[model samples]
Target: MVERQEQAASDAVMTRIGQSVMLHHAGDREEARGRLLDLWTEIGEDGDPLHRCTLAHYMADTQDDPADELAWDLRALSAAEELTADRPAGHEDASAARALYPSLHLNLAADYAKLGRREAARTHLRRARTAAAALDTDTYGAGIRTAIRRLETRLGENDPDDPRSGPPRQRS
Candidate 1:
């Protein structure tokens, strides 16, 4: 019964997060950010790790600044790590948090790239690729793989060690 109640609460939080995501998708970025901030305040720093991870992940997307986005993405990754560490091996929550690692790393990689931190971006990209091995061959998984490849190509083209690599180009 306690577990069930906790699950219900989790579901409620996810639902709210989903609503804010919808707002973001509709281009009401400021409103979405506000809503997510309110949720974060309600959840607090020591809230359920899963809730914190999910909220922070979405929060990163709504940030206008690259530094803020990186901070939120890092928060999401930290929460995911906490969730996996707190749960026993093979437990559902642990497994779920493990599944989040690829995307979290991928987002962090992109954030790093945007900040011109090529070394940090490469590190996270490698982590994302390794973590992606656990993903299923669905559209979501395929999309992530594609994004990873694209980022890899871009990074390769901008190799800092090569004098002919040229200046950094803005991503469309």
Candidate 2:
């Protein structure tokens, strides 16, 4: 059936993305980026939303340029939005896609912070926190929470009105 074929295709794309992520972990960012780019071209922008989300998420990490990273993160977020809109409530795919929003928004916040877009970073950080409420505080969720806290501290330090400001405090 058409649905089965789509699921298979989506699985294949995720496998490829996993391989590229391994390549990235092995420190061959350029090769990983190349592999992701090839996959992106194959998937196209309008491809399966999950495929787009996974690819864009990894592709963002592979970018050397902060601007490019932000662009890919945006793509991931956009694809997640599309996935959310397309799926009916209580569908497994819908739940899976919803699970990605926190990480996607977190990455976007980091990217914006790197680009010196404080307001944008704060906005995405807030969204990430809101999305994270649906997640249990397991290892993955804990990691995201840690990252959120780190970014919050950093942002707070830059705010003159923050109690944590006005001191050259070292980050742990």
Candidate 3:
């Protein structure tokens, strides 16, 4: 009975999150951010790890500043780590958290790159690539892989030590 109740609560939270995501996609970013912030307050800092991870992941997207986005993404990654640590291997939640690692690392890589932390970005990019092997070959997975490749190419093009690489180009 307790398990069922917990599942119900999780489902409710996910539904609300989905609705907010839709609002974001529909161009009501401020409204969506407000809704997500409300949900975060409701969930609290020590809420269920899965819920926290999911919420923080989406919350990162709604941020206006890159630094804020990085902070939220870091929160999401921390929650995912907690979720994986709390669950047994092969548990559904553990598996789900593992699945999130690639994207989380990828986002971190991009954030680090934006901040001109090339070595940090490279480290996260490698982690992302290694974790990406777990991703399925679906459109979402393909998109991430493509983004990783693009970022790698861009990073390679901006080697500060290599004068031949030239000045950093503007991000598209």
The lDDT values for all models are 0.90, 0.86, 0.87
Q: Which ten residues in a row have the lowest lDDT in candidate 1?
A: 157-166
User: Mind giving the per-residue lDDT tens digits that candidate 3 earns over 1-172?
Assistant: 9999989989999999999999999999999999999999999999988888989999989999888988998999999999998889799988988988988998988888888898888888888878887799999788887787777787773434435446766766
Pick by lDDT: which candidate is best?
1
lDDT of 2 at 105: 93
Residue 91 lDDT in model 2?
78
**What overall lDDT, based on C-alpha atoms, would model 3 receive against the true structure?**
0.87
Could you tell which candidate, 1 or 3, scores higher by TM-score?
1
Q: Estimate each model's TM-score.
A: 0.88, 0.88, 0.87
What lDDT tens digits, residue by residue, belong to model 1 across residues 1-172? 9999989999999999999999999999999999999999999999989899999999999999999999999999999999998889798878888988989999999999999999999999888888888899999888887777778777763434334445655766
Score residue 139 of candidate 2 by CA lDDT. 94
Residue pairs with backbone atoms closer than 3 Å in model 1 (clashes): none
TM-score, cand. 2: 0.88
Model 3 TM-score?
0.87
Model 2, 51-154: lDDT tens digits are 89889998999998999999999999899888889989687777788988889998999999999999899899888878887888799888886777688777
